[model samples]
Target: MKQTQFKLICTLMAAVFTVSQAAAQTKEKQIFLSPPLIRSIYTADPSAHVFNGKIYIYPSHDIDTAVTDNGSGDHFAMRDYHILSLDHINGPVTDHGVALDIKNIPWAGRQLWAPDCAYKNGVYYLYFPVKDKQDVFRIGVATSKDPAGPFKAEPQPIEGSFSIDPAVYTDSDGQSYMYFGGIWGGQLQQWATGKYQPNGSKTDLQNDDAPALSCKVVRLSSDMKQFEGPVKDVIILDESGRPLLGKDHDRRFFEGPWMHKFKDKYYFTYSTGDTHYLAYATSDKPFGPFRYKGIFLKPVQGWTTHHSIVEFKGKWYLFYHDTEISGKTHLRNVKVTPLYHRSDGSIALIDPFKSK
Candidate 1:
């Protein structure tokens, strides 16, 4: 089916179900026109991929806070990941449960944040970041043969991953890059007793922040185990080539670095916090001089907005999460909507919560 026709059919099917008595049924018995994609539990930080004709989503699973909340200063305290897949755009979603868990990872603590997956040489690599036993953040790589599977994670994290939100981008020329980091704030440290520690200041977060962070992009080696080159900093630049993120620059990356290749351009996208919004930058080169484009999605109805974009079968969709159903910032549900691009290569802003 063509992309346009498939979307129209989906919209029509959703419309049909809302007019009937079936809408009043219990959560288990009800027929939903557009239900939350994963019904069993809250799933956030969606990373959608097209693998072997199926759309597979690898997202951080948000369980109830009672299980583990070690006072990381953040509400989200995820311990495992679930890989969800759909056969087609309008098909039912299947949850491939517990692809990777922290119990198996010796060095990992609680607080599993955003994760992304990439396929290379018959191996599916699940890249994720989690706080260590000491409450410090780091990124790790897990491997699986099947798209949805019991992925085996490396005992330790990637050599020097002291950040969050790991997003992997495999370019057309067979080169792969990993983009990861947090917002432009000083790295905060805390005691296991939920108290802030003093005399632990390392890097000051400001406009003059080091080039290594502020959204760094580095080339990955063929084995996908280590970095291959100098870590390139990706900050928005002014017309005269001066850095523009912390000062004057409207769209600085808070977290969630997603790299997409549209036509001949590289779209470097991320989410901004404090006042959240989904935004992007474009560049001709993968190791970018990425100029900041305007916001592609105004913040969803949530405290934090993290997303990944994928084009499946000629249709483009933005995979993001929101707290509409859960009513709490920590318990977020994933949302998907069709995305369009302007003729000039900029993406059109989308409201993910708009009614069908």
Candidate 2:
């Protein structure tokens, strides 16, 4: 009887051990799968690039503030920039700390929105948009010797640049161009007459049947300091080649412009602001009359969606942000997932929360 009882006790202990081991394995997998890639702080508007063979993310540092959301984007309240980097796609991300701050910029008033970076002649140029003392948004450029930077801002905003969300794309042959502008709170509407109007329409063109406003693009000077020529409009067209109308909220360019080249074709992707989608358009040339492609990313658990597409180790990845962690639009978190391009060139649609 004693031996039988001892044997029963041993079996129970073994069963308990197995159950604990299985639970631990499940926890490990959950940690690896959960996102907000950098959990130390709130971040948004990820501008990802592969620099020196490492994936570097330049994102707006979102801060908790009492300011309320309004037509002029007063609630975003981003005051600094932080750079995040990773050695591998799913590997650990390192926050390199503040790259630039509002206090250091000589001409900035507030709200340093989405920014992009470009590398040329051994320098990294950080291009951002902020309201000036006159309360108009103007694009600005800052420089750093390191991709993970303690960057120095140019004393003035880019001479002819206006609006927001500056995305710089450098072509294979070596020239670089900047695509910028946004509607609604980004104040793209205020510049409708090609000049800043204090009483300009609070939103877009406002006529639903009218053609939507166009984002602006300009070739960068060799020094990467200023625009080389006049800023031109980047037109987005429908399947029939007609301009997408203002009523098409799901397809029109609202804010957050990103340009990436895949298979020698230029893909211009932007946020469909009110609709909360990441949509793309394709063009044969860098300066585009791009044909609108369907949505690539569905609405996330956030009111805003901004992203960047980059290739690392021959695999494509999409870096974007959502309000999943903080559950507040003004406080966001960045996330990443694999992005696949179909054989016919259309991007495979991504549902960010769908289980793999």
Candidate 3:
């Protein structure tokens, strides 16, 4: 071929390659309705709160590791927490580096899982779950004056706290309650007898016909660092007032508890771990004998489902995470989308994979 012809062919090929690269980059940056709220690093288990008119997210910082999957969550070897903020819905998110690290926590052993943040009387409390030296999961608290923090963890875990997923919800009457617990990898089953049994079953009660395991809730003290009373069972009942059985995986509470109030009714939302559904129940009080409503979020492209619901600027939003970025269970990313409530006082279900 002539030299001029060859040069023209090479130029066309370069242009095609450039276009293809740009397209792939664009696709990589986005999933589920929009790009990840924080893309600089992998994050999951978003605990979002609106503080001082801005949305603050406390998420588990996922690090890539070669830990073999042990079904009890040995593969999710997270070690730190990062705080993310956004001025508005669908706006740019600001990642505020490392808010808390395991190295700085004296009582923490490993695997810093889901976390939540609470602000009271000009102080911000960050609640997280990590394994203690004995390999038992316990909840801990850290404090920071700012919503985004270099928080200082207390020298010890909260007394009588165990398992994973610590979500603190403050009710309208100025009372704060923490809803926490998880099965399987979270080790909720091991603590069923009110004591940590090393040989406890990794999953729920083997009898499917029996009442399923329930999460725990306790009123927070004025200091916001400790519990005010004995932990109570957060029972989720079906429409017929029957306790959901262990076999009811689709509606049973597994992990990731978040409470929000809409129009004077309390909404208790949580993840059905093995089923991967973001289900919710409602009650008239904060510590609820909540009635199971239905699932609001269908499963995404990941194994675990965790989320937070918050209202910002008169609109509600759901902040959740999935493995869309890395396509691996332990490495996930956080994303946000608007949430809506139907006029009949039910939450509209969200299917993340549905087309725009």
Task: List the candidate 1 regions with Cα displacement exceeding 4 Å.
Answer: 1-35, 66-73, 184-213, 247-250
User: Over 4 Å off in model 2, which ranges?
Assistant: 1-34
Ranking by TM-score: 3, 2, 1
The residue-by-residue lDDT of candidate 2 on 5-52, one tens digit each, is 445534543453345334434433332233789888999999999999
Give per-residue CA lDDT, model 3, range 50-112, as digits (tens). 898889999999998998644567778998888999888878889999999999999888899
Mind sharing the TM-score for model 2?
A: 0.89
Worst 10 residues of 1 by lDDT: 184-193
- lDDT of the structure predicted as candidate 1: 0.72
Q: Write the per-residue lDDT of candidate 1 for residues 182-227, one digit (tens) a residue.
A: 7422132212112334323222123235332367788998999777
Q: What's the TM-score of each model vs. the native? A: 0.81, 0.89, 0.90
- What is the Å distance of residue 143 in model 1 from its true position? 0.6
Estimate every model's Cα lDDT from 0 to 1: 0.72, 0.85, 0.85
Candidate 1: residue 253 lDDT (0-100): 65
Off by over 4 Å in 3: 1-31
